[model samples]
Target: MCYAKKLNFKLKTCTTLSRVNALSSVAVKFAAYLCTIDSPDIANDYLKVQSLQEIAALIGTTSRHLNRVLQKWTEQQIISRTDDMIHIKDWQAIQEISEDIRFV
Candidate 1:
């Protein structure tokens, strides 16, 4: 897969820990840097992915509300799409427009 995997600033934690599961691998990498707009609302430690219904139950909000929140974010271009999946362009872009970022 052509992943736009940001050079995670949290690499130290990743290397220090032995077991980085699929969910953790994605969540921690995102949380440490890329989770600004495209992040899930839940504090996904070890990434326990609950169904939409389960998530709605925990947060006391319907899935429709959550979808609306996500849709607004998409419209802002604060986050973006890639091959039907979300990808953070870079860690640095979290604080600014993605287009304003430059590699130095």
Candidate 2:
């Protein structure tokens, strides 16, 4: 049997798991960084200037994958994305997801 055919999990579930784990691993560092800034809204400015490629490099991820994850988060209302900006819409939710490894 092929590798994917043997799994008990759906591919979508697996992808979400991967994204959450990746984001959680980085979230501690990111959340701390956010706190240092005077306002949460300012984070959008930082996100705005960086291309997805640049942001991915900074986060040690592929641009394509990061973009997909961001889009998913946007759809979920965890974040809002504009042409050049990304705004974190829910800090409490973000914190919960970031800190809870068991989240799903």
Candidate 3:
């Protein structure tokens, strides 16, 4: 009976650890996507604050669509754009979003 109880406790601990690892994996994925916001391949260039038209061309998107995306990103505090210039906001804010918008 004593051995059985010990085994059950060990199993519970293992299960809890597995859940933590799973959540970490999800967090990593979220961060990975967020990191792409300032990628040169997307908006890194044209740093002089070019027009949205230029940024759209670089990213292969329409200026209108890019505008909408930018608005949402800004509201989320992920990115900030004034006129044509794009600025990356707090990495911590993005990281916090990554950590929070996760699955169980």
In order, the Cα lDDT scores of the candidates are 0.38, 0.52, 0.50
Query: Can you give the lDDT of residue 73 in candidate 1?
Result: 51
Error of 2 at 51 (Å): 3.1
Local error of candidate 1 at 9, Å? 30
Task: Give lDDT tens digits, candidate 1, residues 1-104.
Answer: 12332233234224423332333322232233233223465333422233544333223346676456445556765456655355544445444432321111
- Worst lDDT run of 10 residues, candidate 3, spans 41-50
Off by over 4 Å in 1: 1-47, 81-85, 88-104
TM-score-wise, the better of 2 and 3 is 2
lDDT value, residue 65 of candidate 2: 73
Root-mean-square deviation of candidate 2: 13.2
- For residues 16-99, what per-residue lDDT tens digits would candidate 2 score against the true structure? 345544644444424332332324444333322237675454445577777777777788898898897779888776666445
- Please provide, for model 3 over 28-79, each residue's C-alpha lDDT reduced to its tens digit, 9 standing for 90 to 100: 4334334544444544221222466744443334777766766777888777
Q: Name the 10 consecutive residues with the lowest summed lDDT in model 2.
A: 41-50
Find the candidate with the highest lDDT and give its number. Answer: 2
TM-score of each: 0.33, 0.48, 0.39
In candidate 2, how many clashes are counted?
Answer: 0
Alpha carbon lDDT of residue 63, candidate 3? 72
